[model samples]
Target: MAGPNSDPIVSATTAAQLPPGAVVLHVEAGDRQSAEAAFAAGHVEGAVLLVRDEVVTRPMRPGDGRHPLPSAEDLADALGRLGVGWDAPVVAYDRQHGDNAAHVVHLLRLLGQDARLLDGGLAAFTDPVATGPGTTPTAVAREPRPWPADMLPDIDAVAAHAAAGGVLIDARAAERFRGETEPLDPIAGHIPGAVNAFYGDNLTPDGTFRDPEELRARFAALGAGPDAVVYCGSGVTACHDLLAIERAGLGRARLYVGSWSQWCRDASRPRATGPA
Candidate 1:
C-alpha cells in the first residue's frame, strides 16, 4: 500500500505556516451548529468552510450526476476566492467527524490541489465537544489563480472503467448501499456489480482514519486493491473511504462523481438491494 499523492491528514498550526510553495488547505465541514462553533472559536488561519450548495459547480442537478465533478474553472474560482492556489497545502476539518470534509477532499484533489484533511477535523483540534462562538478568523484567503486538477472521474468515465473490468466499490454506509434509504437521492440501491465498503469502517475510535496496514487488510478482504473506484451516496463520504485506503497506502482510487445520487437518477442503470 502506498499513500495518496499527498498525506491523508495534516495539522492546522504547522500546515498554515508551511513554506509558500507548499499548498495546505484548512477546510471546515459540518452542519450549521458545528460550523458556527468552529467559526466562533476560530478555525485554522486561512481556512474555508465549504457550504455544500456553494461548493459544487451546478448546485442541484439530480441524477444528472450524483456529485457532479465541478469544472476546473469553477473549482479553481472557488479555491482562488478562498486564497487557495494549486501550490498551497490544503488542510481540511469539520466540527464533528469530518463528514463534509470527505467530499471537500475529493473535490479538491479532483481540481488538482495538493489537499489533505486535518486529523480529527476541528474536533481533533481541542477535541472540542463544545465551542463558544468563535470570532471570525483573521486569516482571509487571498485569491490565487486556479490550478488545474484531474482527480475526479465523470459518470461516463466510470461507466467506461466498469465496462473495462475495473473494480467499482460502493463506499456508502451499509444500509444506504442496501437501498434501505433514499435521503439525498431520487433512487435507492447501488450500481450493479459494485462492492460494499462502508466509509465509516475506515475510522478508528478517535474518528481519525485507521492505520495503513489495517486498511489494507480490510480492503483486501473485499477483493479491492489500489486500483479500485469508490463511490458513495453523492460522491461525498466515499472520498473518506478513498482517503483511508490511500492513507493506509492501498493505492490510488478513482471517484465516480455521480455515485448513488447519479446512479439512482437513471432508471436504465442496474441497481442492487439487500446485503452486499
Candidate 2:
C-alpha cells in the first residue's frame, strides 16, 4: 500500500489492491481488554495489531499528559514482535478517520521506517476479514534505535518556537482553543501565539483526508512549513494533523509531545484566548 515515494496515505480500496506480503496493522484507541475483544471478533487478514496503551503509549506520569509516548526501546521491541522488517511495507488503519492509525504511522516514519495510513480507515476496505486470535511474529532482535530528537519538541522548545515566530499549530477544537470549554486539562485556552487548525478540518464528510491540493491551501493559510510544530490535547491526535501536513507535501513538522498538559503544569507558561 505504499503510495508514490511511500506516500503517507492510502485509500482502503487501494489498500485492497496492495501486493501480497504487505504488513497490515489495525490501530485502535481503547484500553487493553476492549482492544483485544474487538480484535477477537474480526480484523483485516494478516494484520498486525496495536492497541492504544500497549503499542502506542506508556503509563502516564506527573506532568506527562494523558498519553505519554512509550520509550524508544519499548517501541522498538513492539515493532520487532510485529515482524516489521527493516524494509517492510506497513499500513495502519483505524475507524476514526486515521486518528489512531496516524499516530502509529507518524511514529514509524519518525523512526525512519516506511509506513502509511489507510485513508478513510477500516470502513473503506472491502476485503475479507479474519477472526479469532491473531498471530504475532517472533520478536526480532534488531538494534533499538532512539526516537529522533528533532521530531518531538518539549515545552521549552515550543515556547522558543513561538517566541521566534515559528508556527505552533494547536490541533484542538476551536472552542477548546478559545478557552470556552475544556473537558480535559484543567487550564483552558492555548499557548500564546499558537494558531488553531482543528484537526477535523483535514478530513472530508466521508472521513477520508481532503485532496492534497486542498490540504496544501489549508495549511498554507496557517503558515505551515518545515518550521511549523503541531500539538493536540495530549499529543496523540496531533499526529493526525502532522500526517495531514505531510500528505499536503508540507514536509515533516515537529510534534509537541507534552502538549497542553505539560504546558499547563507549570502555571507560568502564558496561554491565549479567543483564537489567534
| TM-scores for the candidates | 0.79, 0.93
Error of 1 at 268 (Å): 1.1
User: In model 2, what is the error at residue 229, expressed in angstroms?
Assistant: 0.6
lDDT of 1 at 108: 64
lDDT of 2 by residue, 54-139 (tens): 87688888868778888877877777787776677788887678878888888888877778888887777777677887986655
Q: What TM-score does candidate 1 get on C-alpha atoms?
A: 0.79
Q: Relative to the true structure, how large is the alpha-carbon lDDT of every model?
A: 0.64, 0.81
lDDT of 1: 0.64
Least lDDT summed over 10 consecutive residues: which range in candidate 1? 127-136
Shift of residue 144 alpha carbon in model 2, Å: 1.1
Full-model lDDT, candidate 2: 0.81
lDDT string for model 1 (149-247, tens) is 234566777777777877889887788888888787777887777889888777788777777788879887776655678888877778788777767
Question: Stretches of candidate 1 above 4 Å error?
Answer: 1-6, 11-38, 127-151, 163-165
TM-score for predicted model 2 compared with the true structure = 0.93
TM-score leader: 2
